[model samples]
Target: MSEILFITREPFAIQGNSRPALHIMPDAVYALVVTDPSLDFEENRAEPGYGTLLYKAPASSDSSDEETTGQTTLHRFAFTRKDLRSTCTEAPVVLKLLEIAKKLKAHVLSDYGALYFRDENGLVNVTEDAQAKSYIMGDKGTRYALTPDGALADPASLPAYLAENDFSFLPETQAEPRAEQPQHSEKPEKPQANSHAPAAPDYCKGMGTLKCSLFSRAYQKNVQLSINAYYAWCLSFLSGINCGYQDFPEQMLRYPIYPSTSNEDIAFLNAYCTRNPDDPFISACLALRTMRLERQ
Candidate 1:
């Protein structure tokens, strides 16, 4: 089994003063505690010094010995003045604690009691929250705060927004029935070059109705439209991509179409509305799509 080093806060003797500490549990029997010198009962807070490591004895069923309740000093570790004020993950003392965990081949448990790992960029949170994972993975384009109707919304409104939207267009799990094959093997006929061909399907047929001004106003306030205009546009945009009408970047397409809106999309719409308030929302979406394609 892998070991774990926990970073937590311990209260000082002085009121309202707390310092970061490290707790390591080698086994179920005993635990180790490392505290800053400023938290020492004999030391003055104004003049902090080296940190101390203590060994906590295991609990006993019988309260026969008084020494079992006390901790024994194991060793003293050197630290700078900046380490005294360390509290966050990037702090000096916290970095030292990470080094210690590295030496022991253990994982660093955050103050929230969740496991975390550090990289070249910074600390990465390992949790079940999708938004938190996206933020840590440098995918800020998936963190938009707009509702389906192009209205601003808070995080608390997500559940209600999701409840109101209809997602019946998504694929079903049950396999569809297959058509029976023809008994006869007939050769296909080729069409004449001069013959008129059928027109291509119109993927973006119903879009370009909502005015940019109305969208901007709705985005400024928490207004809901009678219809889900933004969702309709998203469906149209996705259809355009599927039908090869829109040439969006393959890399950017990895991000989700719904629930994850790009701030760049909102910004482009806002700027286009500032320039052409009477223009349709679909015009801004097309322009943004063209700009993204040009960037590639």
Candidate 2:
């Protein structure tokens, strides 16, 4: 499959760097400023969107960027501090973002955030170095809202500009910074695998088996072996079996237990248990819903 690398940074900084991560594909490289997280999932996507590749959130729910008034759906990728730098002129949208970042604060970038592109032949190649460019430029659209120094005339205009461009680069809104992924040291730390004192059976652990089966069945048809065994516990749920899915690691329990997500198992809990969160069972149900079952 054709894939592109995303060299991204949360702090559009001059020194900190990140490795090139694979992205599925590129959007309109010509559109000056297109969407990131892609406009397709600005709301959040369960599956790839059809046609234009954008997906809509459920009618009943609000968008990831829902406004206080409940009228506007905030765009997810608009004007993020986490900037993307690409040497491709085809990436006009990115050019616009860099210009805006400079205007916001003249923090000349330091470490190169490079994305290596691989064509159909599967030959990985370093296509460009962002440092090669002299000055990052923005599209003409930015001129309309600029002050004498070229920053947006009003803070509101930034949001408006973001809306017009479909939050392609990133939104200017402030969000609670997400926790950083824990980093491991150069030397691997060895651990005794099965050192736990054994877990007691509860609805959450028991129902994890159920999800293992259901999601596994759904996953099998989809053909993703990585998450297959988790379904075994879920399968236990299907047959009305009651046991802690954690007990047997291979088929019964496993290494690298995944954190559970309440959103995923919402339906099964509503059907089999309670809608009220006050119920401990409901809380446990939440734990098993989207738990990865096994580590990546």
Candidate 3:
């Protein structure tokens, strides 16, 4: 509600360069300009008679009094692109700014048209198009297209939309996922003694395999762990089953979901995984195997 903090790259009229700056009301209602100490803006003035003055951010210590001289002086701490780029190892500039803004409960001002922020539901984007009253809510690959009345769309309404439609909506029918043909090698790891007894379940009708792309985007948006970690966790579910990348050809299994998997079914699998975080696949597979044994 209050004037949110903003980080932006300001374009220079004369120098043909853009510099990153932090916008804040350190003590007053008006914003004060701060720039890198290394940039010599005075030399690049548009006219010989025209000159502009700027506050140079302290080179070494922000706590130092040198940069905070007069009534015009603003808060001492300021950062350059290099400073931010080096410090934020987690992500690139814009993404890192979104991370900081989210943490501080602040907003970023931008002319780039798209505003990305981290929310309770993960990363969200509010983008503006060239059309007068055109806007988009959500990411690039998102199927949901939201166009509001004005150029700027309120992100506050996103939660309600999320409540109504969590992430994606699956159609009534999906194509059956085709299974990858088994590859043969001269030397292969033998299936575990118990793994072979449990034949693929009825639920696994088609050649069951999952594409790496499913996890790729999910990995990027995930904050808890690296993409590799998520991928590894997904694969870990099959380690004991002798289903995935292993020597056993006949027992090769794909993720139970296929192109034909209904939205409800996919949601169910997601819910099952969420409920049984420790071992969803193993539990499902074990249950199927038990059912088969019971029938025998």
Top-scoring candidate (TM-score): 1
Candidate with more favorable, higher lDDT: 1 or 2: 1
Q: What TM-score does model 1 achieve against the real structure?
A: 0.26
TM-score of each: 0.26, 0.20, 0.19
Q: For each predicted model, how many residue pairs clash, with residues at least 3 apart or on different chains? A: 0, 25, 6
Model 1: residue 272 alpha-carbon error in angstroms: 1.7
Name the best candidate (by lDDT).
1
Q: Residue-wise lDDT of candidate 1 within 1-296, one digit each (tens)?
A: 22233532111111221211122211100001111222211222333222333222233232211124444312223222212221234233345555444433334454344545556776543443322322110011123243323232365743443332211111121123656545688885653221111122345355456666777776567354522566457446745565673363342434344433444455445544444456666666654553443223
All models: lDDT? 0.36, 0.30, 0.30
lDDT of 2: 0.30
Q: Compared with the true structure, what per-residue lDDT tens digits does model 3 show for residues 1-296?
A: 21222342111111211111222111000001111232211211222211222233333323322245443332222332111111211223335455434322234443343344545666544434333213222211122222342211344654443433221112111122557535554665554322212344456422123322333334335633543343344335444465543785433444344444322222323322332233324333333322222112
In candidate 2, what are the lDDT values of residues 129-238, reduced to their tens digit?
54332221222223332332324436565554443333223212323255753565466455212111112245355434243234434433655453344344444453
Candidate 3 or 1, higher TM-score: 1
Give the lDDT of residue 214 in candidate 1.
75
In model 1, the Cα lDDT at residue 79 comes to 28
TM-score ranking of the models: 1, 2, 3
